[model samples]
Target: WNYQFLTQLGYPSNYYAAGEMTVSQHLEVSGQPDPYNPGWVGLDYIFGSGMRGGSSGGPHIANLGEIVDSATDPGQFPDRNTIFAVTSWGYGLGNSSGTEIKIQGASPLSGVANANNFVDLFNAACRRSRAHFGTWTCDLLVP
Candidate 1:
């Protein structure tokens, strides 16, 4: 994460850590309507890490950084946008919301494609700015 974005999220800067996902989950849309992939669909990848707190609708960035900027609304810094996945459920619910954040199942390709569409629209709407944010209204961004 960039120090500018970090600070904007109300966190102290100077922190840089990376994690490698060690798991992959496959699923079926038997009882559901699959958008990304029709029947017998498979998800990209699912991961688990130790995150205490973060915004629910924030973006999930890849190590490469700035895959697609999605936060383009007011109060959101388009220049600091770098999203690969839409932040989904987490592990601090009953006790906070949940910390087991995972990338949207549509990410890898389908999800990213959908997000790209939004990004494009966002850029057009925000004068060539990202449409999503890693921490738009986040309360905290610390380890």
Candidate 2:
């Protein structure tokens, strides 16, 4: 799904790099539910090279790069934020590559009074299932 849904739920999207500049990267989201918290859903993708080392995990450990918000309140949504960690493999690295996206909040999801409300909104949107690529996800995060 696109970040628009996340923004609709009041979440910000952050980006990061995984390894060297040569490695290609992207984001993926599935309607997977969080096994640890059924009340919460999950979106997972490989971050950087799952291979480890050789510029693995990129230059930053916690890359909270940017934030995008809706133009309007959009009604009944909590203020949530998403942080992404990305990694890549150099040319000819073979199958030595992977990438990941991590969605966290500036504050704990449970701490936000509107947390459940936003989750409900996200679930409603997920029924339609929208996926995007490149930096386009950034636009989706804002209105």
Model 2 misplacement above 4 A = 1-19, 43-143
TM-score of 2: 0.21
Give me the overall lDDT of model 2.
Answer: 0.33
Task: Give per-residue CA lDDT, model 2, range 54-106, as digits (tens).
Answer: 34333212213344656565445343344332233222223435434233221
Put down candidate 1 lDDT per residue, 103-132, tens digits, no spaces.
232232224336545644544545423335
State the local distance difference test value for candidate 1: 0.33
Candidate 2, residue 34: lDDT: 48
